[model samples]
Target: MNEADALDLVQFAIWTVLIASGPAVVVAMVVGVGIALVQALTQVQEITLTFVPKIVAILLTVALSGPFVGSQISSFTTVIFQRVQDGF
Candidate 1:
């Protein structure tokens, strides 16, 4: 493949990865911030306070978003395979 085609493929791969992981990352960030705020307000400066909620939230997000993420990855993979078949 030419340089442009290779770059396009790399960009697509990165975008697909970002899309697939976005929900979990967002959930984790939100949960972490919320927990940190609570800790600050309540004066409970326990570092461990952040982990459980973040983990749970990320897990829930993954569970809820699993099908969508899977479909996105599957479609990207299909496109990549098709591009290979097309000799791009």
Candidate 2:
């Protein structure tokens, strides 16, 4: 309803997004680094080597973390809806 309220909502939205994305991001980073190390050691330098494993790992992470991410988003939505209901 006001700047502070708007800012609060925005901040909360960002945090929710970060929380939801945390696992996937972490998995991707780890997978990417591992792949990079392997490529460095083996000197394969294949584009697919860099991308494929990272993609697969990220997909698997998302699949495994689906429920946790869903609940975080759902909770954020609930809070937003409640604010709307309260005419904020």
Candidate 3:
């Protein structure tokens, strides 16, 4: 592949990674923020307070979004293979 083609692939790879990880990451971030807020209000400044909720939420989100993430990765793989076959 040429430089432009390589760059396109890199861009696509980034997008694929973002799409695959988006749900879990977003859920984790939201859960962390919520926990922080609760801790702030209640004066409970426990560092461990954020871990369980974030992990559980991230797990649930990943489980729920498995198909979407799988499909995105599959599509990206197909595109890559198609480009290879086409000698692009």
Measured by TM-score, the strongest candidate is 2
Question: Candidates ranked by TM-score, best first?
Answer: 2, 1, 3
Off by over 4 Å in 2: none
Candidate 2, which ten residues in sequence have the lowest lDDT sum?
A: 45-54
- lDDT (0 to 1) per candidate: 0.91, 0.94, 0.93
What is every candidate's alpha-carbon RMSD to the true fold? 0.9, 0.7, 0.9
In angstroms, the error of model 2 at 86 is 0.3
RMSD of 2: 0.7
Candidate 1 has its poorest 10 consecutive residues by lDDT at: 47-56
- lDDT by residue for model 3 over 29-48, one digit each (tens)? 88988999999899998878
Q: Could you say which candidate leads in lDDT?
A: 2
| Residue pairs in candidate 3 whose N, alpha carbon or C atoms collide under 3 angstroms | none
lDDT of 1 by residue, 1-88 (tens): 9999999989999999999999999888888888888998999988788887888888889999999999999999999999989988
Cα lDDT, model 1, residue 9: 86
lDDT tens digits by residue: candidate 2, 1-88: 9999999999999999999999999999999899889889988989988888889999999999999999999999999999999999
- Winner on lDDT between 2 and 3 is 2
